[model samples]
Structure formats: C-alpha cells, structure tokens
Target chain A: MAPALREFCYWMDRYRRVWRGTVVISVANPLLFLAAMGAGLGKLVDANHSGHLTGTPYLDFLAPGLLAAAAMQTGVIEATFPVFQSARSGGNYPAAAATPMRPVDILGGHLLFVAFRVLLSGLLFLAVVVAFGVVGPARALLAAGPVLLTGMAFAAPLMGWAVGVDRQSRLNGLYRFVVMPLYMFSGTFFPISQLPHWLRSVATCTPLYQGVALTRGAGLGGSHPGATAVHVGYLLALTAAGVWAARRSYTRRLNR
Target chain B: MGDESAGAGVLIEAVGLRKVHTPRGGGEATEAVAGIDFRVHRGEAFGFLGPNGAGKSTTMRMVAAVSPVSGGTLRVLGMDPKTHGPAIRARLGSVPQDDTLDTELTVRENLLVYGRYFGLPRAEIRERATQLLDFARLVDKADEQVEALSGGMRRRLTIARSLVNRPDILLLDEPTTGLDPQARHLLWERLFRLKQEGVTLLLTTHYMDEAEQLCDRLVVMDHGRIVAQGTPRGLIAGHCTREVLELRFDDQEAAAGKIRHLGDRQEKLPDRLLVYADDGEDALKAVHRTGVEPLTALVRRSGLEDVFLTLTGRTLVD
Candidate 1:
C-alpha cells in the first residue's frame, strides 16, 4: 500500500467507532430540513409565487438547493475542527510524521478520507430526495456529482487554513462570519435575482452559489452546456488550489 | 561478535551536526545543536544526558530524520538523512517525550493502525499487536480507550506502537521524565531487555541514575554542547574522586573556610559542602579535627552527578 493510503486507514479505523454519532448531521439534519422547509414552508411559496419559481414546485427547487448547501456545511465542518486537532501538539500528525509517512502523505490521506465522507453523505441525501419525488431517480443521481464537488471545493482549502490556526476560537469565527453567510445568501433558499444588483454578483462569486446552480440545473433539466462547464470548472480549480495549499501548510506545521 | 552482525557497522554517525531554528514571525535564529559529533555502534545502548533545553531532543529529532539539519552531515543506517529521510525513518522507531497515542482508539488498535503505516500485511500486524500488547503489559486493557489509561500505561503503549515494524534502531526522548519511580523502573527494565535482545537503543534523559542504569556510553550536554562523553564509570573516574563526603553545617561558608585543606577538592552548595576524596571517612574525620562541628555527614560513592557538577560547576536538574 502507498503511505498515504496507509495513513488513510488510521482515520477509517477511528471513524468505525464514532460514525454512529454522525448520522444526525449526515442523514437526520438534512432530512428534517427537507421535510420542514421543502414540504411545509415550501407549500406557501408554491401556492402564491408559482410563476416566480419558473413553474417548478418549491419542493422540487428547494431539495437540490438544500443538497448543495448541506454538502458545503458538512465539508467545512468536517475539515475544520478535525484538522486543527490533528495539527496541534500531542496530536496524530506528529506521531504519523515520526514513521515513514511524510507530511504530504499525511495531508493526502486526510483529504482522501474527507472526500469519502462527502461522497457517502451525498449518496444518502440523493436517495432521500428521490424518495420524496423531488426529482427523478436519474436526475437525483446526476446531482450527486455536483454535490460531492461542491463539498470538496469548500473542504479542501479550509483544511489548509485549519492547520495553521493557533486556537479553536478562530474556527467558530469562520463558521459565523464566513460559512453561515454563504449558506444563507448563496441562492440556496431563494433566487439570487431577488437580491439587489451588486449583491447578486457577489453571491455568484461564492463557491456555494456555483454548487447550488449546478445541483439545481442537474435536478431540473434545463441547463446550458456552456454554463454547466463554467460551474464544474470553477469547483475543480478551487479544489486543486486547496490541495496545493494543504500540502504547503502541512509541511510547515508538522515537519517543523 | 558474530561475523554477519559485525559487518553491519555503525547505526548512526554524525560530524558537526547542527540545527538552527528561526522564530516564526521575526527573531534571531538560535542554534539548537551546535556542531556536535557522535557515533552509535550496532548493538549498544547510547544516551544523551543533559538538563532541560540542553538540545538533547533537538539532536534526537535530527537523528530520527524528522527535523532538517542546519549544517554538517548526518548518516543513519549508511544513508544521508537530508536526502533519504523517509528511507532512514522506515528502519527506525521513535518514542517522543509526549504520548501521542490516538485517544479515540483502543490500546490494541493504536498498535495495529501504526503498523499499517509501514504497510505491513494485516495478518502480520495482527500477530504483532497481540505480542506488543503483551510486551507493554497492556493485554488486559487492549480493548479500552487510550484516554482511560494512566500516564505510565499510555507511555508503554506509545513504546509498543513504535515497535510494530520491528525497527532496527529505537529512539526514546525523555521516556521517563514524568513517570513515578516504580513506573520509571518498569520502563527501564523493559528498555534494558530490549537492549539485551540487541535492538540498539538511543535515548535522552535528565536523570543521572537512568543514564547510569541503562547507557553503556553517554554524553553530558549543556547549552547545545557536549562537555564530556564516556561510560558512566569512566566519566566519574576521570572527573571526580572515588568518594564524596557531604557535610551540613549551620554556616557553610564559615565551615568551608575552616576545613579547606581536608580533601582534594570541595564544592559548597547552599545547604551543604561536598568534599571529594579517595576516602570519604578520612575526609569526614579530618573535618571534625578542624573544629567545625557539622550537624550531619554522609559518605558515599561518586557517580555521574559529581562528574556533571565537576565538569559544568552546576547541578543537572536546576
């Protein structure tokens, strides 16, 4: 086995005993949000502003939006505290670095595990969305690709930043000032076109907006190929950049 | 020595090895390892004995192939550390000062997962985990979380985890620094057994007795420099007398002036006076004849403590 894969087994072994507690975030939280917002609150919006929703039901539009948003939340949440813990003194990064594993191998293994987590959660969310009749099975399955990519785009760079953090309080600020704003305003719950002009452009620049657009287009079936290419390209480039940053941060923090 | 084993040669060789750490923001770069030279033979226990912040851990980090060297050259297992760090590390096991065991995993899982880092086969790692649990005396706590273990147990597990690959050389930095006496002795015994089994051991410690108990050879370090290097007995013999006579007087300064001519050399500590002489009993008698009535007196064999005091003119722990 390669060293990175070997380091990956360490996290997998740890997750085996603690994965039960995470079902709430991965399965339950999204399910509850879908039921309350998509079915309950969505009822009022569909009954009145059906024309504004482009003739699609609010439940249909909100399901894929929630899927993309949930991926962002899970990806950032998973990448932040765990990365900080591993990079801290008396943590596993130093221990792993003591063996044949290099700092790059350590970062690679951790990101690989994060990708697995995002993919697993995305699949679960898609299955539930399909059951609700929000989108067809084929469309829901296609949406999974964009959902996973969206998660990685957020998770990868945050992993790098978390390694250099001096304390846990910085992570809380990131959630409040960065992640929460992106979640609330990135065209997840409503269309960005409703926003004032300048704010719409700002929302479009955020990674979560691209994610929301991709999943919504894949689920509803009317996206232009050129626009779809743009969304995918943007997410791919961000994820690659995040990986590069994480490699540099891990070497500086762990190897020292 | 057997021919095959003898041909293996020195396990580690360093010439003027150095490490300089530049502060993160903007500060002067301090040299942690100031151009030191040392060698470790294949099957002996070698040690670095020094006080805290004496560059012992820094030197150990460089030899373990984790910290980059600032100057000079270092070779481990006949490979240059700068170019072949991963390769050198593959054959070595490191037990750091802190216990970095995975707290979420069980004691047995810690060993098993660490073994996987070396890409060992699953069956082999399983077998190794069982034996290592037994070796660490953690068989009963194998299924328990690491957080539930005591400091000593956690330390033993750390040591056992480092051995999963059956490494050729084992590096321990301050292994018993925070343990209780019984725990320290237990760890020492385990380390002694490993040394007897011919797993070359390199360790750093502040306790003079630990060095005397385990090290076949040692170097006394202070301020990033080696002051003396030799076997415990040889170091004591070279730097101190055969015995030390300690006297506690109400006024040490006054008593020191009175009994100045009694011994070969005298060191006055805050509470007592240490007289170095071949015969401590005779030295004590000489002090009494000089009309200085000490409240208490002791005669004992000289050891590494005196050697360090004689070489550096200071105590080791302070």
Candidate 2:
C-alpha cells in the first residue's frame, strides 16, 4: 500500500503541471449547469407548475441531482482518457512497470487519483450550489459524500473498460449510446416517478439513479430508512466489483 | 549457448529461454523465442544482434522482467523473473525499443517522476536528475516538454531516466534505431561511459558496427535461435577469412564462371560476389590475372556481417 501511494505521488507531480486547466473545468462545470438548468429552466418550471416539483423551489430539487451527475462525469472522465493514455500511448505504465512498481500498484494509484478528483469535484459542486442559495442548510454538504461515491462507482468499472479498449475512438460510442442516455433519463433532470412505471424500473436499475436518489435524500432530509442501506450497499458492491475487474484487467494487459 | 561473460561472474544466466505471445482476440499463439540461451556477467557489455523478427526485443523484455518467460530456467541478479519480478526489476534499469516518455512533462520532471517510481527520495532524485541531465547533455533543455524535443534528445533523456535508480544492470533495446549517425554516435559514447562506470549493459541491435563497437560479447540471432556467439573479432575469425574481396560485375554469369578458383571460397550475391581469402590482395591480383575487368572491386576486413552471412546464409537486416 505504501509503494502504491508512492506511485500515486508520481502522477501527482505530472498532474500538478496541468492542474490549473483541470481546476478551471471542474469549478466552471457546476456554475454553468446550475445557472442554465437550475436558474433559467427552474424559473420557467416553477412559474407554470409550482407544487408538482416536491413542494420546494425547483432549483433546490434540481441542485442535488446535478451534483450527483457532475460527480459521475468527473469520475468517468478521470478514468477513461488518462487510463488509456497511461497504459498505451503515453508509455507511462510501461515506465512504471520497468520500475519496482507492480501492476496492482499502478491500478491502485490510478484509481486513487480518480477518487481524489471526484472528491474535489464533488466539493466544488456543493459549494457552487450553496453559494447560489439553493441548498437549504449546512447539512446539505452531507450530500457530497454520496455524490463522490456515485462518481467513484462509475469510475472504477469504466477504468476496466477503458484499458480493455484498443482505440480511443471506440469511447465515442460509449458516450453516445450509454452515458448520454443514462444522464438524460436517470432522474438528474426530473423525477423518475413522472415517467411510465415500467420506464421507472429501468431508471431505477442504473447506478446514477441511485446516486441521484441518495444525494437528493441527503439534501432534502427525508430519505427512506430502508432504502439508505440498499443504495449504499448497491454502490459499494459495484465499486468493489469494478475494482476487482480493473485489477485483473490491468495485470493482464500491463504485465505483458 | 552457455557462452560465459567476458571474465565477470554471471549476473544473468539462462538456459533454453523461450517466449510465445498469444495474439489478442483469440488468434493462434506465435513463438517469438525458441529456447535460446546466453549469459551476462557483472560490469560487461553484452548484446543480442538480430533483425526485426529475430526476437531480440522479446529476449530483452524477459530480462527486464516485464514479460513472462514461457520455458527454461532464467535468472537475473540470481533471482527468478517469474516470481521475483519486482525485486529483480528494482535492481535493473530498462530502456525499451520505443520512447514512452510522458510527453506532457518536462525533461527534468520526467527523470524526477521516474525516480519516484523506484521509491527514491525527492531530494535525492533531484540531485541525481541534475547529474543525469548533464551526463545525457540535456542540461540546457531541462525545462522543455519532452514533446518539443527532437528524437535524439528524447532517446538520451529516456536513457538518463533509466539511470535515476543507480541500477546495477541496464537493459537497452535498440537505443539508436531511428537516430541519425551523429545522434547514434553521441548516444553510443554516453553508453560507453556507463560501461566504463561498471554498469552491466544488455543491448540489442541489428547494426553490426554498433554490436562490434559497444559489446564485449554478443550472440547472433536468426529466426529466434542463436546462430553464433563470441567477441566481434572471435566470431569473424572463426567463421570468415581474414579479409574479403568484393567484386561487382555487370555480367554476373561471366564473373561467377571465371572467378571460382581465385579465392579459398566464393559467395555470389544478387549484385556482387564476395571472394574469401587469407590474403585479399593476392585474391585481387589473381582476379586481375584472369583478365576479367569488373564494374567495381574492393578488399575489406571481415566483420560481424560476414560472420552472420556465413552462419545463417542470409543478410542481417534482410
């Protein structure tokens, strides 16, 4: 574990050079989404349909959903391009393999950096929403934990997928076919209950919907006691499984 | 091929080492190494001389402990690569055939970051990076991104980065494959200095001149097998005559029929014929005495290329 952390620090030095660009993107992301989706669209919805959006201002209801979605996107981005680049094009993985570092250490270090970015992005998202005066109280910050979890849950599995892929262009199909559809229908923009009951089941089965539910419950303060364990369990199990697959895949692909 | 290193106790020992790569998407497995053996001792520069498909890089990869061995007993620093890969790798440095530097990082930072992979202290790594940059003659370009540098500079920086750990054994696979003559000479000079500093070097090359210049002992590989092994002079002396008379004739059939008895042995190439003799000048005079005026003629010392041609009956690069 210590050696793995040392490997993590190596990337930190490299990441430090381009961190400003990452910070600008991470900090700017939530402000734009909250301004456009929360302020502009929420006012129109609140004016036409007041009580239909869970008895609060629509901005308050939408803030937490966007937070979870932002976290998921941050985690996925961290894992996809960088993981593929490090292993193949960038030649960093082979360099590390030539050293004392093992394939597991490389995978651990990569995932560790991704988790850090997700946490940072999650915190930035929460602060943006709080500064806009949308979140009700201080406890709204509690939602950041589940949001980061949701991000990592998506990140770990996507890392395994990214390293297994040969061409970077194939990732476009993943975004267009899989990620975009989930982002639109996974209760980030609206409540899943508004959809047909059968469509709600499909939305419920996805990880982002659970993330939205967990974060929204934490933000609004009325999460069902029974579903809390279920959501946490689902995300934790997915994270563990994803990490296992990533470890195996990295060992096979990297230790050639 | 149990050829010992040049007077140094063996640091690397192998017997019938083999490698077979299974192509992705479930294709048939292709054998890259066919049970070849060699050894490298401390403070000696050893090499594998072969062409593109001769499995030089595969053998180098196995020695680096990044690629697993398929068969035979192999030891690096007296440790088995199959189980003690990390432990063995921690003691050795590797420069692969291709440059994989993190192009985003500056040259100095590339060295610094690679040192951290070996778990070196930052202050120590910083100190060593300074020395290595000077050694590679890249001190002036320390702050430049690797992507901005030329290919020769990147190759030097890559070699310098591998030395950050002060490793006992250095494995360089075709360190100068794409460089121009000037750049290749500069790199070779730096590598010779490392060999003088007592770093055990294991390099692979198809350039016979490079093998002869940098290697104390080397093995000639063809089609995944060791065809010959010795010092550059030893291999040439054992397989070829003292000198060769190269004659190019526009009329190939006329030269072949007439020059058969001029030298001890004769080889007919597509464009030229090589006449082997203990005294090349005597063979040239004998050719002239036959009254055959050729298109071109020259007498040269036998080299690793002649030895390779003798053992494999094929050109090294072809």
Candidate 3:
C-alpha cells in the first residue's frame, strides 16, 4: 500500500503541472457539451414529442446520461496513452521496477491515480449539472455513485488492455470503435427502448449502459434495490477483473 | 576472483547461475546467461566485460533481482532473490543501459519521485534532491522537464536518481554506452568519487577501456559464458605479454608466415597482425630483421583488449 501510494504521488506531482489542460477536458468540455447537446438540442426534441421522453424534461434526461458517458470517456482517456507509454521499452515502468517497488505496486498506484482523476472530474461535472438545474442537489449527490464507478469500470480494464497494446495508433482505434460506439448507442442521447429490440439487449449488458441506467434512475427519482445492486455489481465485477488482468500483465512485462 | 578481497564479505554471489529465455512466440529457448560463477565484495568496483549480446546485461539483471534465475544458487545481500526481491532491491540501485529518466517530470522531480519509491520521507527526499541536483550538475535545470535536457545531462540525472535511496550496491549496465567522450569522462569521475565514498559498484560494458578504468576486477564474457576473470592487468599478463607490436601489411597471411617467430605469440586480423613479446620495440626490430617492411608498425603496452583477443579471438566491440 505504501509503495503504491508512492507511485500515485509521482503521478500527482506530474498532474500538478498539467492540471490546467485537464480542466478544459474534465470540466469545461463536459459543460459545453451539456449546453450544446442538452439544452440546445433538447428544446427541439421537447417541442416535437413532449411526452416521448417519459414526461420528463429533456435536459433532466440527458444530463445524467451524459455524465456517465463522460466518465466512461474520461476512464478510457486516462487509461490508454499513459499506460501504453509506460509499458513501452525504456519507459517509466522499467524505471520504477528498478526500485524496491514491485509490479503490483506500480499497477495499483496508476489505477489509484486514474480513480483520482475520474473522481475529480465527476465531482466537477456534477457541480455544473446542479448549477444548470439539470438535477437537484440531493439527486446529483446520488448520481455521483454511478458516475465514479462507471469511470473505474472502464478505467481498470482499459488500463490492463493498454499495457499489451503494441502501437500508439491502436488507442485511436479504441476511441473510435469501442468508446464512441458505446457513447452513441448506450442510452446516452435517447432511451435504449428507441433502439432495435436485439441491440437494446446488447446495450443493457454493457458497463456504460448500466452506468447510464443507474445515473438516470437516481436523477429521475429512484430505483428498486434489486436493480441498483445489479448495476453496481456489474460495474464492480468488470473493475475487479480488469485490476486482476492489469496486475498479471504488469508483473509479466516488468519482472521478465 | 579477487583473492586479495576474499576476506571481505561477499555482497553478491552466483554459483553456476543460469537464465534461459523462452521466446514468446514458441521458438527455441535461448540460454542468455549460461552457467557462470563470480562474487562481488562489499566495496569493490566489479565489472562484466564483454561485447553486446555476451550476457553481461543478463547477468546484471539477475543480480538486480529483476529477472528470475532459471537454475543456480544465487544470493544478493545474503538473501535469495526469488523470495526476497523487494528486500534485496531496497539495498540496490540500478542504472540501466538506456537512460530511463521520466521525460514527463522535471530534473529534480525524477530524484524526488524515485526516492518516494524507496519510501523516503518527503522532507528527506527534498534535501537529497537538492544535493543530487548539484551532484549531477543539473541544479540550473532542476525545474526543467527531462525532455529538454541533453543526452549527457539525462544520463547524469539517471545516475543521481539511482543514488536517491543511498543504496549499498549500485548496478550500472553500460552506463556510458551512448555518451560522448567528454560525457563519459565526467561520468567516470562521478563514479570514481562514489567508489571513494565506499559504494559497492557493479557495471557491465563492451568497452575494454571503461573496464580498465573503473573496474578493480572483472570477468570477460563471450556468448553467455565467462571466458576469463581477474584484474585487468592480471588477465593481460596471464594471456598476453608485457607489450604488443601491431604491424599492418597488404598481405597479412603471407607476412604472418615470415615474422611469426619474432614475438611470443601472434594474432592475425584482416588489417594487421599483433606480435606479443616482453619488449614490443625488440619485437618490431625482429620483424624488420625478417625483411617484412610492413605498411605500418606501432608498439604499445598490452591491455584487456589483447587479453580478450587471446582468450576469445574476438574484439570486445564490433
């Protein structure tokens, strides 16, 4: 635990210098996205089919879904490039390995750092969601649970996968093929009920869809205890699996 | 191998150490560090002298406890690496062949963060960073990112980072392989100072001059095996003569037949022939007496290069 925190401190020290650039992505960009896509486009959808969105305001429906998706994007972004860079030959992991720190410590530290970023982004994003009247204070507080877990579910696994990636260009493909598709299809913009029946079932199983469902459920008012547990459980399972994979991969690559 | 240092405590020992690396894609298993044995004393500057791919770095990796030894009895800091890697590593400082400085961090932060890896307190690390910055001569660039530094500065920073833990044994693998002559000299001076400070040093290099300069005792490795092990002067004395006379001829094979008897032994290269004798000048006169007016002739004292040539029939650096 101490060694892992040391690795986390290394990232924190680096982050202190680069925090300004991240604010734009984590806070401003998501707000801008809310304004343009939620309020700007919501007015159109609300007027044409006022009751189509379950008799709730379109901004209310879109905000929490967007928050969950943003967390997913943040998770993937945080995990991909930096993880690949460290796993490369002559990169940071080998340097870290030379110290008393073990491979598990290195992996734990970076994942902890990613979780920090996701939490910071989630908090700031939720603050704006409340400021925009998207969700009330109590509901926004509830929504934070899924928002942060959603980030880890994606973060832990993608970090594991990123370690094995051979090329930098493949990360671009991940954003295009994996992340963007989930963002578009996983009930972020509209209800998954609007999709084809078979595709809706597929979306339901995805971690992002679970995230969107939980956040939207919390924002809209409430959900059954059983449904909430399933959402949280699914995300937890993926995160655990991802962390296990990451530890194995890091030890294999570094310890030789 | 250093009989004089036998009374000193052994900090690292390997008996018939072996490392076999099976390729990831299912090829023949390559024996990287074939059966070898050596011991490093507490404060001696030991080295592994060999050409590239001679298993010098492989052996260093094993000593560092980063790579698992396939077969053999190996101990570092009186502990088995397989069971006590972290404990062993806590007392070891490693400077890899390539500079692994964090390009993302500032010059001083490299030391700070690495110190934290060893669980150094923040205040202690800050004080140490100040001293290490001065040591590496990068005080002016302490806040600058590593990417902004020159190759030499980066190498210096790496060495400084390795020292942040105040380690007992410092392992450097080809520490000056890619540096300029001036950079290499400055690094050697820094390393010499560390030796004066009583830090146990273990390094590997393909440069015979580097070995001769830094190492008190070294082992010559070829194709994953130790070909010879001793002090540089001792190996040269045992395998070669007091001096060497180099003669270049247009036809080395024909000229070799004529002057072969002049020296104690001879080594034929594509461009020149080396004549070993007690006195190189006398050997040169003997070659002249043979009427072989070689293209060029030079006489110099024998060194590790000659020792390796005699032992392995190959140069240290290709």
Model 2: CAPRI class: medium
Model 1: how far residue A149 lies from native, Å: 1.1
Q: Write model 2 residue lDDT over B183-299, tens digit each, in one string.
A: 999999999999999999999999999999999999999888999899999999999999999999989898789878887788777888999999999998998899898888899
For model 3, residues B1-318, the per-residue Cα lDDT tens digits are: 222333568888899999999977799999998999999988899999988899999899989998889999888888888888998898899999888888888898788888889987889999999999999999999999999999989999999999998889999999998899999999999999999999999999988889999999999999999999999888988899999999999888888889877889888876788998999998888888988899999999999999999998988777
Q: What does the lDDT come to for candidate 1? A: 0.89
Q: Please state the Cα-based DockQ of model 3 relative to the true two-chain complex.
A: 0.70
- Runs in model 3 deviating more than 4 A are A50-52, B1-8, B251-262, B289-293
Each prediction's total of clashing residue pairs, residues at least 3 apart in sequence or on different chains, is 0, 0, 0
Candidate 3 chain B, run of 10 with poorest lDDT? B1-10
Range of the 10 consecutive residues with the lowest summed lDDT in candidate 2 chain B? B1-10
Look at candidate 1 and tell me the lDDT of residue B236: 92
RMSD of each: 2.7, 3.0, 3.0
Give the per-residue lDDT digits (tens) of candidate 2, residues A64-110: 88888888888888889888887883378888888988889999988
- Which has the higher DockQ value, candidate number 1 or candidate number 2? 1
